[model samples]
Target chain A: MRKKANPFFYLFLVVFVFFVMFPFLWMLLSSIKPLSELFGDKAFTPFSSHPTFQSYVSVFVDYPFMRYLWNSAVVSTITTVYTVIVASFAAYAIARLQFKGKTFILGIVLSVSMFPQIATISPIYIFLKNIGLTNSYLGLIIPYTTFALPLSIWLLVTFYRKIPGDLEEAAKMDGATLMQTYWKVIMPLAVPGMFTTAILVFIAAWNEFLFALTINTDTNYKTVPVGIAMFQGQFTIPWGEISAATVVVTVPLVIMVLIFQRRIVSGLTSGSVKE
Target chain B: MKNSGMEGQAGVELNKQDARLPVKKAPKRERQKKESRAALYLVAPAMILIFIVAVWPVLQSFYYSLFDLRLSDPKKSEVHLKYSVDLGRYLDNYPFLISSIDSEIKKGNDAAELQDIKEKLQSLDEKLQKDPKVKSQYNAVNDKLMNFKQPSEDIRFADVEKSTAEEFSKTTESVSSQLNKAAKKTEFTQEKKLLGLASGMKDSIIKPTFIGLKHYKEDLTEPRMWRALGNTLTFTVISVAAELVLGLAIALLINKAFFGRGLIRASILIPWAIPTAVSAMMWSFLYDGQNGIVAKLFESVGIVDKMSNLLTTSTGAMFSVIFTDVWKTTPYMSLLLLAGLQTIPSSLYEAASIDGAGKWKQFTNVTLPLLKSSILVALLFRTLDAFRVFDLIYVLTGGGPANSTETISILAYKVMFSQTNFGEGSALSVIVFLCVAVISMLFIKFLGRDLLNDGNGAGR
Candidate 1:
């Protein structure tokens, strides 16, 4: 049924995989090494003679990493939930209903996605400061939702278009109103699409650094990326602790990617590629 | 007889239904109107949120760029349309300075000159209190200071006429200089303290710093801004071109139905899944001067002359950043192109092969042409992203080794937060926004014409 693969194909695959995974492997190896070997000449050794979890222990004890993790989780969760709900409603209206100025609205959404965050950060910081929302979770959540809405809406619109229109017509024939049909009939069928968008938005919010760095500067409100960036030591740079923290923050994201690779790929490529 | 009766009844019913068609059209029109209204309701929340967070802030940044706003200077921290005076600062030093002068006059060292200076100071105080608004604010601030309570910002400053402000500043400056001269000539103990208070009073006069378009003109002529822009363009072009070639190769490799393709795809996402800041930090470690493995490898392999040369030298730092970016983002590029590759039917390849085309010929004739739109779209996204790079370079070299690697966004951030020059920073931000708009327009006009039409159809 299929031709046998060539030796060069496997060789190329191994090389590609090695190139992509080298950093992660190195990161993992470096995280497990003790400080003495990490900074000493033995650092070039492929494996440490005495690998330990001291860096991981120090990361949790020496810094307020647990708080950073909690903050990132809270902000990212709220942003993902808020963005998906609002974007879903807007996407449905554009996909399933005929409305005036639909093209104009889509244009606005598209342009907003391409807007550079640096340009809008100053006013956002000032506004949040005025309202006493800076250094709070709500400040980050609001901007994250605003930035994530465009992509989520675009992805959901593509998904919503794939569902047959006859289903809604059938619901209408059964005496269901427009709102009821949207709530009970269409939403259940669109759950997978919403889930895919949720994953993409969550990763985006988790990875957002600029707003989190500028807006929430208080130690109590720092997220993972900002917290890691601000790590320091008296004389030497704390490479082991930083590597441990990076490993801690990145493992969950890697697992998520592994589990939902297909969904994420489809969500990313939905608008760009033709079906 | 039954057939004829049924036919006659059916004909009568059809005629009645046809007569009611015009009447039914009214409700259909009303339903269409209601649906449009419902669409507005559904879209209102997202639109309002975006306007609040994104659109309104850009307008506010534009407005702020029109004035001189520096957080370091107390007087210029806030925008002032009219001349005003900080009564708290004025009252704090005014009473002490007057007493010091009076004490000097009592000592009778330069009694005649001191008397003349006292009379001038009295007239300046009277000139200031002549305004009813200033008098009330002055009294309130003085009372609060005496009671050891701090005055609020709103009541601390009071607006004054331009002429009155000019006279007050002039008298204080001259009197301070005279006092300094007197302190030098006479060994008066309180004269030093007196001069200190007098100099502090000079800053109480708050002049409006609303120089319109000054920051924009300065930034436009500034060599640093131009260099930063140039650096951003160089990074965007070189890194994107590298990613395109490598990503196309990876896409072609994975498009074949091979064993463990899923595992390869998943592993490829690891680089992309890591945050840019974290990756930048990782590369910084790998490129460390003494103990870095990658740096040593490069030196031994003859890519660089020394291990430390990777991040310490300007060209090497730029190369290091671009290399890290290509490593981090090639997976994303590959994925996008792979999506495009998957869309190409197998029959096309089969037809080409049947026509006696080789692998390279097939790729040139079929894959390149079909993948053009995807490549363009991917380049547009990656170019814009690379132009606005902040987290990577910010954490890596900090735009340093003499700021040779600074991009526009990094420069804007430094100007805004590190230096606390919001007005100039805002001007830079507006320029960045304009560049982004121009880039988007160029992409759409030249390369994305069909893509835009396709996007509109998909949106509809």
Candidate 2:
């Protein structure tokens, strides 16, 4: 038997939800509104009198928006793939194998992951310069994989440890080699964990600003975040185009994150929460 | 029987390592050793990658902080061991300048002044001839200049002593300044050319720039660095505290069974899920003085007297950034706390209620104590993150309206990239790392003791 809530409770919920949703809603509405109406001192309503797709169209026509999207996509995809592969191997060894210094290695990974990116920039920049990797996709991919590995390993290790030991024992009893059991049984069970790690890694690489800003100087190689920030006009900032670009870059990520909301939440909280 | 069997097993295990009569146990041990080797192989790629990517760079950053590396100055672009002369640059300008000076003196216009300049040039050239290596390189470079060939970098550069470099630079400066004054009065054909060439020679002297810890000393004394750090600390402390309170409330609110809980949870996560850069840009518009609805709303609420004041004033910009950060991250904070909340049994709440504990009493006695570890973990992560903040504050205020909002990370970036001062930038980066390490140590040493102690006590 559910009891009726107080009126103030409903009011609080309504206000809280509205406050949470306002920025996104504002971004959407502002993206569609004509430039003239977007800045006017009108009541804060959801719609404008003259709505247009002019800003969205201009983002493509007047800028290298598509190129930035491609660069971001390629970088993020490669980063996710590399991070997942490297993290899985290390995580599997950590979770199951009776190896010496396993605890020490995990501790190192955790501490390094906490290191501020600023500390690593100058050396990485110089190192990449020495190796001729600067302004290249491989440049961004390597560091992204390096930084993402610790978290990916941590999350995957948590999941891998939760698997039943009997399952692996059964695989061994059925004439399976150690590699064969890992490939067939463990891989299948760990797929969801890998998927979650991949999504988070992709999102992280996609949104990364500092390295992307520093590593790629050529506009041809710049990622979305840097590209959008560098968008310029002769005398004025074209706010409409910027807002449209933000919407373009952000909406797909928002949709994807919402779609995979449960997996993301679980992946994020699993390591930190000590059950 | 059990004790005897265990002792027998232990005796066999102890003797197994003696390798005398334990052939049957050897295969299992061999397999275990092979597995350990395999694990090492499995972990090698990641370890090497991490070293190259993460560990190596930090070490490299520390190395770079010792030098005075500035990309804008060609001489300081790379580390130098000895004071070197760009024989190529010297040859390119020296011969032409001498010929021009000779021609102007021959023209009999400003003869005395031109002769003085020529004598200064000759003395420096004679100084150059004193060193055997410099003389040989100078001759070879002079030959190249005669041939109108681009001097090869290897053959065209030679090291000079500190005194020679200083004397040569001083002479070049006086000669150029004198020529500059003479060129105004003389209508000689090559007087202007002589002045330009002399000044170019001054730039070719590369100094040994291995200034160990000078940048660190300079930055430590610089007030701008301290101000940026203070701003970062202020933002971290205030924003994190706000997020904690709001996150705890939201966690409590959502922890209870309610209608539309899933929708509320999903909607709240949308803020956290958006890319920080995009959200920062979005907030930039909302904080825009001219047309931002959020700014207008703030004005209406009397938070500020003017709509434009939010991002344009020092206090308002800091407040706006912190508010935006709280808006974006409270959901994440709540989610972490909710995970902690889930672990608390409802029986504890029921028992508290039976003990005449009201809601606030239950919250203090039950929720707060149980949530300590979770709160600590959340605070640790958020504090480190908030401390290293760059993109949001970067995009929003741009550390601006007078750089009042610039954090240490943004300051490092501006110094390193925008100004191309890599040495000082690296020092700032090391400082940030030190600060982060200290914060992590504090959390682990103090709060982590309780978190770990409770686990051990409970497990036993």
Candidate 3:
């Protein structure tokens, strides 16, 4: 049986959760407030006298936010799919096969993940410009996959290592080919790991800013993060529209976190803790 | 009798099987080879993509650091191997300038000065056309100029000897400046055209600008780069240190079986889960000078004299950014520590209690010692990330309030993209990479050694 928690523990927990959730709560409240209430003299009021969806409507109407959302979806979805497929192949090789230079390859992935994106920005911009690939979905997707590969492969490798070797051995004994064994036996069990990797990579791609800002100058190709950042009016910022945009982009991610909290936690720790 | 006979027959069969073992081993070796090849095949796609997307770009950036590349100037936009001429540019303006000079002389005003300038220009043009290839290209360019058609880039440029390029550039510059001065003494119909065309021709004398190490030298001497780096260091150190302490406390609290543990754990991830850019925008609102809740709280609590001070003052801006970063990332730090906490056996705390040790004593002896590696890992990740902070500062402040919050990454972005100075920008990028490499090296050398020592201790 667990020991009874101390009274101070509850007090500390309350403070901790309050600190953690305060900004989010503030953002939510700001999003629903009408402009007059938001910028009024008594803006410090906890809630608006009248709650409205005007900011949300204005976000979609004032800018091409729907287009930006579509762009982010297209780029992020493709990046997630490609990153998973590519990382899975390599992760399987490293985890299951005995190969030369495996340690060297793993080291490369680790070091590359630590590479600062700023270092590669200029060259990648010049390269994409030369090849006429800038402002296109492929341009952003390529770098996103490169940056996400190392983490995706690392997490999947740990996951692959924990599966019983006997399963694959049994499949091979039953006259299954290598592809058949992986597809029919190994992959079915690795779905949870793959889902975790996909979610992490999708969030990364959706949230990446430097590349999105550098690669696409056209308004039509801007992702939500870049587009939202570029929301400036003549004299001051449109905080209402920005807050609405933030809520729109962030709610989906929060929902994903709610649905896959355990998987995300495991994936994060496995990649970092070296267990 | 039957068993003895079967044994003798089995002995003969065993001898035959042993003789065929070499043949079977050869196929096994080949199978192993095939498997290795398959492994290579499986990893090839990812490896090749990484080389293209990650490795090649770094190499390209390194290559660009060796030149004086600026996109604003036409001559310096691309790398030049040798002295070359924009013959079309020269021809487009040189002939018109000569005719305008002819008209000036025809007006019989400052005829001697005009004649001297015309002779110099004619000689420079002749020197440029001295090379046979250049002569051919020059004639083609003149024809295109006469026809009022723009010359293609390939046909407009031709390589020249270094001496010829120097001589032509000097002559054109001298002539252009002289024409400007001479025009001051006269009021002629073609004075404006003459000066305009002459100045235009001065830029047409393309000279090679391959200044290796110049960008690096400038960046190394510039105070702004160092200041940006100092700001980054300040942010990294303070924010990481704060997160470490707070994260440990949270990890200790949650390590025990608590009611609603799952809900608390998930809620903690909300700040970390939000995109950094989005959260930065949220903080910008919370730190807004006019109507920010945090600013109001700070003002009311006497943290600042005014609400706008949080973002408008340099120290306050730094404090605000670091505090926001700590708030967003402490959960991540706590989560990592929580994983470490779970690994520590409950028996240690129980044993401590049996020995009559207090909570603080038990933490110092058991928890801190065991949690070192996790703390090291978390610090390393956060340090590297905070050092390379770009999106947060970029969106929230644009490194504003006189660039008090600018980091090296923001400076590099401003140089490379906004100012379009790729050479200096690439040098800054290389500097940032070197700093990061040093930081990682220091972490691995020190922290990794501790981890090793702990492993050996455990083994003993």
Off by over 4 Å in 3: A1-4, A172-177, B1-28, B98-123, B130-132, B139-147, B177-189, B351-357, B447-460
Candidate 2: Cα lDDT at A162: 65
Per-prediction CA RMSD (Å): 5.7, 5.0, 6.2
Cα lDDT tens digits, model 1, B1-460, are: 1233443454465446546765533355576798889999988888888888888888888888888988787778877778999899998898888888888888886877777778888899998998888898888998899999999887899999999889989999998888778777777757668888989989999998888999999999999999999999999999999999999998887787778877887887878877788888888888888878899899999989999899989999999999999999999999999999998888898999999999999999999999888888888888889888999999989998999999999999999999999999999999999999999888877664565345344323
Tens digits of per-residue lDDT for model 3, B1-460: 1233443454465446646764432354565687778889988988888888888888778778878888887778887768888887777788788888898788897899999999998888777777889899888888888898998889888988888888877888899888788878877677778888988887776666677888889998999998999999998899999999998888887887878777787887778887788888888999999989999999999988999999999899988999999999999899989998888878888988899999899999998888877878778888999999999999888887788999999999999998999989998998888888899888877576442222112111
Clash list (residue pairs), candidate 2: none
Could you tell me the lDDT of residue B163 within candidate 1? 91
Where is model 2 more than 4 Å wrong at Cα?
A: A1-11, A126-135, A170-177, A231-235, B1-29, B94-149, B152-156, B159-200, B447-460
Question: How would you class the docking of model 3?
Answer: acceptable
Tens-digit per-residue lDDT, A113-196, candidate 2? 889999999888877887998898988887786578887887788777666555665565465777898899999999999999
lDDT of 2: 0.83
TM-score of chain B of each: 0.87, 0.81, 0.85
Best by lDDT: 1
Candidate 1 lDDT score at position A12? 86
The DockQ score of candidate 1 comes to: 0.50
Query: What are the lDDT scores of the predictions, listed in order?
Result: 0.85, 0.83, 0.83
